[model samples]
Target: MSPIELNKRQEEILQIVKNNGPITGEQIADRLSLTRATLRPDLAILTMAGFLDARPRVGYFYAGKKSAQALGDTMNNMKVKDFQSMPVVVRESVSVYDAICQMFLEDVGTLFVVDEQSLLVGVLSRKDLLRTSIGRQELNQIPVHIIMTRMPNITTCKKSESLIEVSRRLIEQQIDAVPVVAEEPAGLRVTGRITKTTITRAFLSLSESHEL
Candidate 1:
Protein backbone atom coordinates (compact mmCIF):
# COMPACT_ATOMS: atom_id res chain seq x y z
CA MET A 1 0.00 0.00 0.00
CA SER A 2 1.13 3.59 -0.64
CA PRO A 3 2.31 5.42 2.48
CA ILE A 4 -0.32 7.54 4.19
CA GLU A 5 0.47 10.45 6.47
CA LEU A 6 -1.71 10.76 9.56
CA ASN A 7 -3.80 13.92 10.01
CA LYS A 8 -3.89 15.89 13.28
CA ARG A 9 -7.00 14.09 14.54
CA GLN A 10 -5.48 10.77 13.56
CA GLU A 11 -2.32 11.69 15.49
CA GLU A 12 -4.46 12.59 18.49
CA ILE A 13 -6.26 9.24 18.25
CA LEU A 14 -2.92 7.44 18.11
CA GLN A 15 -1.73 9.36 21.19
CA ILE A 16 -4.92 8.48 23.03
CA VAL A 17 -4.50 4.80 22.15
CA LYS A 18 -0.88 4.93 23.29
CA ASN A 19 -1.78 6.55 26.60
CA ASN A 20 -4.69 4.27 27.37
CA GLY A 21 -5.11 1.32 25.09
CA PRO A 22 -7.04 -1.80 24.51
CA ILE A 23 -9.59 1.04 24.64
CA THR A 24 -13.01 0.60 23.07
CA GLY A 25 -14.09 2.86 20.19
CA GLU A 26 -16.90 4.26 22.36
CA GLN A 27 -14.38 5.16 25.10
CA ILE A 28 -12.11 6.86 22.55
CA ALA A 29 -15.07 8.81 21.06
CA ASP A 30 -16.14 9.78 24.58
CA ARG A 31 -12.62 11.11 25.32
CA LEU A 32 -12.97 13.43 22.32
CA SER A 33 -16.64 14.12 23.18
CA LEU A 34 -17.65 12.82 19.74
CA THR A 35 -19.92 10.01 18.57
CA ARG A 36 -18.38 6.61 17.79
CA ALA A 37 -19.43 6.98 14.11
CA THR A 38 -17.39 10.18 13.81
CA LEU A 39 -14.21 8.34 14.95
CA ARG A 40 -14.89 5.14 12.92
CA PRO A 41 -13.24 6.26 9.67
CA ASP A 42 -10.14 7.52 11.52
CA LEU A 43 -9.80 4.30 13.47
CA ALA A 44 -10.25 2.26 10.28
CA ILE A 45 -7.51 4.25 8.52
CA LEU A 46 -5.11 3.84 11.46
CA THR A 47 -5.82 0.12 11.84
CA MET A 48 -5.35 -0.54 8.14
CA ALA A 49 -2.14 1.58 8.13
CA GLY A 50 -0.76 -0.62 10.93
CA PHE A 51 -0.55 2.22 13.43
CA LEU A 52 -3.26 0.65 15.52
CA ASP A 53 -4.48 -2.95 15.86
CA ALA A 54 -8.03 -3.84 16.81
CA ARG A 55 -9.60 -6.99 18.26
CA PRO A 56 -13.17 -8.31 17.82
CA ARG A 57 -14.60 -7.54 21.28
CA VAL A 58 -11.46 -6.41 23.17
CA GLY A 59 -10.93 -2.97 21.50
CA TYR A 60 -8.01 -1.05 19.90
CA PHE A 61 -4.32 -1.03 20.99
CA TYR A 62 -1.20 0.85 19.96
CA ALA A 63 1.08 -1.07 17.64
CA GLY A 64 4.30 0.20 19.23
CA LYS A 65 5.52 2.56 16.48
CA LYS A 66 5.68 -0.34 14.05
CA SER A 67 6.66 1.59 10.95
CA ALA A 68 9.67 3.41 12.44
CA GLN A 69 10.80 0.41 14.46
CA ALA A 70 10.51 -1.89 11.44
CA LEU A 71 12.67 0.46 9.35
CA GLY A 72 15.25 0.66 12.14
CA ASP A 73 15.39 -3.15 12.41
CA THR A 74 15.82 -3.49 8.65
CA MET A 75 18.73 -1.05 8.58
CA ASN A 76 20.36 -2.63 11.65
CA ASN A 77 20.20 -6.06 10.01
CA MET A 78 21.89 -4.90 6.78
CA LYS A 79 25.45 -6.29 6.74
CA VAL A 80 28.53 -4.28 5.77
CA LYS A 81 29.61 -7.03 3.36
CA ASP A 82 26.56 -6.36 1.21
CA PHE A 83 27.47 -2.68 0.80
CA GLN A 84 31.27 -2.43 1.09
CA SER A 85 33.39 -1.55 -1.93
CA MET A 86 36.95 -2.61 -2.80
CA PRO A 87 39.49 -0.67 -0.73
CA VAL A 88 42.13 1.58 -2.23
CA VAL A 89 45.28 0.63 -0.43
CA VAL A 90 48.75 2.18 -0.27
CA ARG A 91 51.79 1.14 1.68
CA GLU A 92 52.53 2.95 4.95
CA SER A 93 56.00 3.77 3.67
CA VAL A 94 54.61 5.47 0.57
CA SER A 95 55.55 9.13 0.34
CA VAL A 96 52.84 11.65 1.22
CA TYR A 97 53.11 13.16 -2.26
CA ASP A 98 52.65 9.74 -3.85
CA ALA A 99 49.74 8.95 -1.50
CA ILE A 100 48.03 12.16 -2.54
CA CYS A 101 48.45 11.25 -6.20
CA GLN A 102 47.04 7.76 -5.57
CA MET A 103 44.07 9.22 -3.72
CA PHE A 104 43.27 11.57 -6.59
CA LEU A 105 43.78 8.85 -9.19
CA GLU A 106 41.50 6.52 -7.25
CA ASP A 107 38.99 9.37 -6.79
CA VAL A 108 38.50 8.50 -3.17
CA GLY A 109 38.41 10.77 -0.12
CA THR A 110 40.42 8.34 2.00
CA LEU A 111 43.04 5.63 1.43
CA PHE A 112 43.80 2.57 3.53
CA VAL A 113 47.41 2.40 4.61
CA VAL A 114 48.82 -1.09 4.90
CA ASP A 115 52.15 -2.68 5.75
CA GLU A 116 54.26 -4.75 3.32
CA GLN A 117 52.40 -7.86 4.51
CA SER A 118 49.07 -6.25 3.41
CA LEU A 119 48.02 -5.84 7.04
CA LEU A 120 46.05 -2.70 7.86
CA VAL A 121 48.35 -0.18 9.54
CA GLY A 122 46.76 3.25 9.16
CA VAL A 123 44.30 5.50 7.30
CA LEU A 124 45.09 8.68 5.37
CA SER A 125 42.61 11.35 4.32
CA ARG A 126 42.72 14.34 1.97
CA LYS A 127 42.85 16.70 4.95
CA ASP A 128 45.91 14.92 6.31
CA LEU A 129 47.74 15.31 3.02
CA LEU A 130 46.68 18.96 2.64
CA ARG A 131 47.69 19.84 6.22
CA THR A 132 51.05 18.13 5.88
CA SER A 133 51.77 19.54 2.40
CA ILE A 134 51.18 23.19 3.42
CA GLY A 135 54.41 23.80 5.38
CA ARG A 136 56.48 20.76 4.46
CA GLN A 137 60.02 21.57 3.34
CA GLU A 138 60.04 18.31 1.32
CA LEU A 139 56.66 16.72 0.49
CA ASN A 140 58.17 13.70 -1.28
CA GLN A 141 60.42 12.90 1.69
CA ILE A 142 57.54 12.74 4.19
CA PRO A 143 56.14 9.24 4.78
CA VAL A 144 52.34 8.74 5.17
CA HIS A 145 52.94 6.73 8.36
CA ILE A 146 54.02 9.93 10.10
CA ILE A 147 50.75 11.75 9.46
CA MET A 148 48.22 8.92 8.99
CA THR A 149 45.91 7.78 11.76
CA ARG A 150 47.55 4.57 13.03
CA MET A 151 46.07 1.26 14.13
CA PRO A 152 44.11 1.10 17.42
CA ASN A 153 43.14 4.70 16.65
CA ILE A 154 41.70 3.83 13.23
CA THR A 155 38.08 2.61 13.29
CA THR A 156 37.68 -0.60 11.29
CA CYS A 157 34.69 -2.88 10.74
CA LYS A 158 34.22 -6.50 9.79
CA LYS A 159 32.20 -7.76 6.82
CA SER A 160 29.65 -9.43 9.10
CA GLU A 161 28.97 -6.26 11.05
CA SER A 162 25.74 -4.31 10.57
CA LEU A 163 25.71 -1.23 8.31
CA ILE A 164 23.83 0.63 11.05
CA GLU A 165 26.74 0.09 13.43
CA VAL A 166 29.25 1.12 10.75
CA SER A 167 27.21 4.22 9.95
CA ARG A 168 27.09 5.07 13.65
CA ARG A 169 30.87 4.74 13.96
CA LEU A 170 31.38 6.85 10.87
CA ILE A 171 29.19 9.65 12.27
CA GLU A 172 30.45 9.40 15.87
CA GLN A 173 34.10 9.30 14.83
CA GLN A 174 33.56 11.94 12.11
CA ILE A 175 35.46 9.97 9.48
CA ASP A 176 34.83 9.83 5.75
CA ALA A 177 35.22 6.07 5.46
CA VAL A 178 35.98 2.87 7.33
CA PRO A 179 38.24 0.03 6.22
CA VAL A 180 36.51 -3.35 6.23
CA VAL A 181 39.02 -5.81 7.65
CA ALA A 182 39.44 -9.39 8.69
CA GLU A 183 41.30 -10.57 11.79
CA GLU A 184 44.59 -12.28 11.01
CA PRO A 185 47.27 -13.88 13.14
CA ALA A 186 49.43 -10.79 12.86
CA GLY A 187 46.84 -8.02 12.56
CA LEU A 188 43.72 -6.84 10.73
CA ARG A 189 43.94 -7.28 6.97
CA VAL A 190 41.99 -4.89 4.77
CA THR A 191 39.24 -6.53 2.72
CA GLY A 192 36.97 -3.70 1.62
CA ARG A 193 35.85 -0.15 2.42
CA ILE A 194 32.58 1.54 3.45
CA THR A 195 32.12 5.26 2.81
CA LYS A 196 29.44 7.83 3.44
CA THR A 197 28.42 7.51 -0.19
CA THR A 198 28.05 3.79 0.23
CA ILE A 199 25.79 4.29 3.24
CA THR A 200 23.67 6.76 1.28
CA ARG A 201 23.28 4.36 -1.59
CA ALA A 202 22.34 1.56 0.75
CA PHE A 203 19.71 3.72 2.41
CA LEU A 204 18.28 4.73 -0.93
CA SER A 205 18.11 1.12 -2.02
CA LEU A 206 16.36 0.18 1.20
CA SER A 207 13.86 2.98 0.74
CA GLU A 208 13.09 1.87 -2.81
CA SER A 209 12.61 -1.71 -1.71
CA HIS A 210 10.24 -0.65 1.02
CA GLU A 211 8.31 1.45 -1.46
CA LEU A 212 8.04 -1.54 -3.78
Candidate 2:
Protein backbone atom coordinates (compact mmCIF):
# COMPACT_ATOMS: atom_id res chain seq x y z
CA MET A 1 0.00 0.00 0.00
CA SER A 2 1.18 3.52 -0.75
CA PRO A 3 1.97 5.72 2.27
CA ILE A 4 -0.04 8.81 3.11
CA GLU A 5 1.77 11.98 2.10
CA LEU A 6 2.47 14.43 4.94
CA ASN A 7 0.24 17.49 5.20
CA LYS A 8 1.52 21.00 5.99
CA ARG A 9 0.88 20.73 9.74
CA GLN A 10 2.38 17.27 9.87
CA GLU A 11 5.49 18.61 8.14
CA GLU A 12 5.78 21.38 10.70
CA ILE A 13 5.37 18.90 13.57
CA LEU A 14 8.19 16.75 12.13
CA GLN A 15 10.45 19.77 11.85
CA ILE A 16 9.78 20.73 15.47
CA VAL A 17 10.50 17.18 16.69
CA LYS A 18 13.67 16.90 14.60
CA ASN A 19 15.10 20.05 16.14
CA ASN A 20 14.21 19.35 19.77
CA GLY A 21 13.45 15.67 20.34
CA PRO A 22 12.14 14.10 23.54
CA ILE A 23 9.89 17.13 23.65
CA THR A 24 6.50 16.74 25.34
CA GLY A 25 3.23 17.02 23.49
CA GLU A 26 2.16 19.85 25.74
CA GLN A 27 5.30 21.81 24.83
CA ILE A 28 4.64 21.25 21.15
CA ALA A 29 1.00 22.25 21.67
CA ASP A 30 2.08 25.41 23.48
CA ARG A 31 4.47 26.32 20.64
CA LEU A 32 1.69 25.86 18.08
CA SER A 33 -0.79 27.80 20.33
CA LEU A 34 -3.26 24.94 19.98
CA THR A 35 -4.79 22.35 22.32
CA ARG A 36 -3.09 18.93 22.65
CA ALA A 37 -6.27 17.29 21.35
CA THR A 38 -5.91 19.11 18.04
CA LEU A 39 -2.37 17.70 17.63
CA ARG A 40 -3.28 14.15 18.71
CA PRO A 41 -3.98 12.77 15.24
CA ASP A 42 -0.91 14.39 13.70
CA LEU A 43 1.32 12.90 16.41
CA ALA A 44 -0.18 9.44 15.92
CA ILE A 45 0.35 9.55 12.17
CA LEU A 46 3.99 10.50 12.52
CA THR A 47 4.61 7.69 14.99
CA MET A 48 2.78 5.15 12.86
CA ALA A 49 4.68 6.11 9.70
CA GLY A 50 8.14 5.73 11.32
CA PHE A 51 8.73 9.42 11.72
CA LEU A 52 8.59 9.56 15.52
CA ASP A 53 9.04 7.39 18.59
CA ALA A 54 7.16 8.12 21.82
CA ARG A 55 8.19 6.83 25.21
CA PRO A 56 6.16 6.58 28.41
CA ARG A 57 7.71 9.56 30.21
CA VAL A 58 10.45 10.55 27.76
CA GLY A 59 8.00 12.15 25.34
CA TYR A 60 8.31 11.96 21.53
CA PHE A 61 11.76 11.52 19.93
CA TYR A 62 12.78 12.06 16.35
CA ALA A 63 13.20 8.89 14.29
CA GLY A 64 12.83 10.63 10.97
CA LYS A 65 14.95 8.33 8.82
CA LYS A 66 17.98 6.09 8.75
CA SER A 67 20.94 5.97 6.35
CA ALA A 68 20.70 3.51 3.46
CA GLN A 69 23.29 1.19 5.04
CA ALA A 70 21.52 1.34 8.40
CA LEU A 71 18.20 0.49 6.79
CA GLY A 72 19.72 -2.44 4.86
CA ASP A 73 21.42 -3.72 8.00
CA THR A 74 18.13 -3.53 9.90
CA MET A 75 16.30 -5.49 7.19
CA ASN A 76 19.09 -8.10 6.99
CA ASN A 77 18.82 -8.65 10.73
CA MET A 78 15.20 -9.78 10.38
CA LYS A 79 14.70 -13.60 10.50
CA VAL A 80 12.49 -15.75 8.27
CA LYS A 81 10.77 -17.44 11.20
CA ASP A 82 9.52 -14.08 12.35
CA PHE A 83 7.77 -13.39 9.04
CA GLN A 84 7.02 -16.60 7.06
CA SER A 85 3.50 -18.00 6.64
CA MET A 86 2.28 -21.59 7.00
CA PRO A 87 3.32 -23.90 4.15
CA VAL A 88 0.78 -25.31 1.69
CA VAL A 89 1.54 -28.96 0.91
CA VAL A 90 0.29 -31.88 -1.17
CA ARG A 91 1.28 -35.50 -1.73
CA GLU A 92 3.39 -36.24 -4.81
CA SER A 93 1.01 -39.11 -5.58
CA VAL A 94 -2.00 -36.73 -5.78
CA SER A 95 -3.33 -36.14 -9.30
CA VAL A 96 -2.57 -32.92 -11.13
CA TYR A 97 -6.31 -32.26 -11.01
CA ASP A 98 -6.34 -32.47 -7.21
CA ALA A 99 -3.23 -30.30 -6.94
CA ILE A 100 -4.78 -27.64 -9.10
CA CYS A 101 -7.95 -27.76 -7.06
CA GLN A 102 -5.99 -27.47 -3.85
CA MET A 103 -4.09 -24.47 -5.23
CA PHE A 104 -7.35 -22.70 -5.98
CA LEU A 105 -8.86 -23.74 -2.64
CA GLU A 106 -5.91 -22.41 -0.71
CA ASP A 107 -5.47 -19.35 -2.94
CA VAL A 108 -1.77 -20.09 -3.28
CA GLY A 109 0.40 -19.79 -6.39
CA THR A 110 2.59 -22.78 -5.47
CA LEU A 111 2.33 -26.06 -3.57
CA PHE A 112 5.03 -28.24 -2.03
CA VAL A 113 4.82 -31.94 -2.82
CA VAL A 114 5.73 -34.37 -0.04
CA ASP A 115 6.24 -38.12 0.05
CA GLU A 116 4.79 -40.72 2.47
CA GLN A 117 7.26 -39.66 5.14
CA SER A 118 5.94 -36.08 4.76
CA LEU A 119 9.34 -35.00 3.41
CA LEU A 120 9.73 -32.58 0.53
CA VAL A 121 9.76 -34.28 -2.86
CA GLY A 122 8.77 -31.77 -5.54
CA VAL A 123 6.89 -28.55 -6.22
CA LEU A 124 3.84 -27.77 -8.35
CA SER A 125 3.55 -24.33 -9.93
CA ARG A 126 0.66 -22.72 -11.84
CA LYS A 127 2.62 -22.94 -15.09
CA ASP A 128 3.35 -26.62 -14.48
CA LEU A 129 -0.35 -27.37 -14.02
CA LEU A 130 -1.35 -25.21 -17.00
CA ARG A 131 1.07 -27.05 -19.29
CA THR A 132 -0.30 -30.40 -18.15
CA SER A 133 -3.89 -29.21 -18.54
CA ILE A 134 -3.26 -28.51 -22.22
CA GLY A 135 -2.01 -32.05 -22.84
CA ARG A 136 -4.20 -35.01 -23.79
CA GLN A 137 -3.44 -36.84 -20.51
CA GLU A 138 -6.17 -37.14 -17.86
CA LEU A 139 -5.52 -34.62 -15.05
CA ASN A 140 -6.90 -36.87 -12.28
CA GLN A 141 -4.91 -39.92 -13.34
CA ILE A 142 -1.58 -38.11 -13.79
CA PRO A 143 0.34 -37.87 -10.48
CA VAL A 144 1.87 -34.51 -9.60
CA HIS A 145 5.37 -36.07 -9.53
CA ILE A 146 5.12 -36.41 -13.30
CA ILE A 147 4.74 -32.65 -13.80
CA MET A 148 6.10 -31.05 -10.64
CA THR A 149 9.59 -29.54 -10.38
CA ARG A 150 11.49 -32.49 -8.86
CA MET A 151 14.21 -32.91 -6.26
CA PRO A 152 17.69 -31.39 -6.66
CA ASN A 153 15.94 -28.67 -8.67
CA ILE A 154 13.57 -27.44 -5.94
CA THR A 155 14.71 -24.38 -3.97
CA THR A 156 14.42 -24.46 -0.17
CA CYS A 157 15.34 -22.32 2.83
CA LYS A 158 15.60 -22.66 6.59
CA LYS A 159 13.59 -20.82 9.24
CA SER A 160 16.80 -19.42 10.70
CA GLU A 161 17.76 -17.76 7.42
CA SER A 162 17.48 -14.02 6.72
CA LEU A 163 14.61 -12.55 4.63
CA ILE A 164 17.00 -10.48 2.49
CA GLU A 165 18.87 -13.63 1.38
CA VAL A 166 15.59 -15.41 0.59
CA SER A 167 14.28 -12.32 -1.20
CA ARG A 168 17.43 -12.19 -3.32
CA ARG A 169 16.94 -15.85 -4.23
CA LEU A 170 13.30 -15.24 -5.14
CA ILE A 171 14.26 -12.33 -7.45
CA GLU A 172 17.16 -14.18 -9.13
CA GLN A 173 15.09 -17.30 -9.76
CA GLN A 174 11.87 -15.43 -10.59
CA ILE A 175 9.85 -17.71 -8.31
CA ASP A 176 6.77 -16.82 -6.28
CA ALA A 177 7.53 -18.60 -3.01
CA VAL A 178 10.28 -20.54 -1.18
CA PRO A 179 9.49 -23.33 1.24
CA VAL A 180 11.08 -23.03 4.66
CA VAL A 181 12.54 -26.50 5.24
CA ALA A 182 14.10 -28.53 8.00
CA GLU A 183 16.97 -30.80 6.99
CA GLU A 184 16.13 -34.34 8.01
CA PRO A 185 18.19 -37.52 7.68
CA ALA A 186 16.09 -38.71 4.76
CA GLY A 187 14.83 -35.43 3.19
CA LEU A 188 13.76 -31.86 3.71
CA ARG A 189 10.63 -31.24 5.81
CA VAL A 190 8.44 -28.31 4.93
CA THR A 191 7.56 -26.07 7.88
CA GLY A 192 6.55 -22.74 6.32
CA ARG A 193 6.79 -20.56 3.22
CA ILE A 194 8.02 -17.07 2.22
CA THR A 195 6.54 -15.36 -0.79
CA LYS A 196 6.79 -11.94 -2.45
CA THR A 197 3.79 -10.94 -0.37
CA THR A 198 5.46 -12.09 2.83
CA ILE A 199 8.54 -9.93 2.14
CA THR A 200 6.34 -6.96 1.33
CA ARG A 201 4.32 -7.40 4.51
CA ALA A 202 7.55 -7.53 6.48
CA PHE A 203 8.50 -4.05 5.28
CA LEU A 204 5.09 -2.65 6.08
CA SER A 205 5.08 -4.28 9.50
CA LEU A 206 8.56 -2.87 10.15
CA SER A 207 7.34 0.63 9.47
CA GLU A 208 4.63 0.15 12.08
CA SER A 209 7.17 -1.07 14.61
CA HIS A 210 8.94 1.24 17.07
CA GLU A 211 12.26 0.95 15.24
CA LEU A 212 13.31 3.29 12.47
| TM-scores, each model vs. reference | 0.66, 0.66
List model 1 lDDT by residue over 112-209, tens digit each: 99988999999998889889989845989999999999978999999999888998999999999999999989999999999999889776555543
lDDT score of residue 153 within candidate 2: 92
Q: CA lDDT, every prediction? A: 0.83, 0.81
Off by over 4 Å in 2: 1-69, 210-212
Off by over 4 Å in 1: 1-69
lDDT by residue (5-92, candidate 2, tens digit) is 5666778888899898889989888888987856765675566556788998788999865322244555665777766788999998
Q: Give the Cα error of residue 65 in candidate 1, in Å.
A: 24
After TM-score superposition, the amount by which residue 140's alpha carbon in candidate 1 deviates from its true location, in angstroms, is 0.9
Candidate 2, residue 19: the lDDT equals: 91
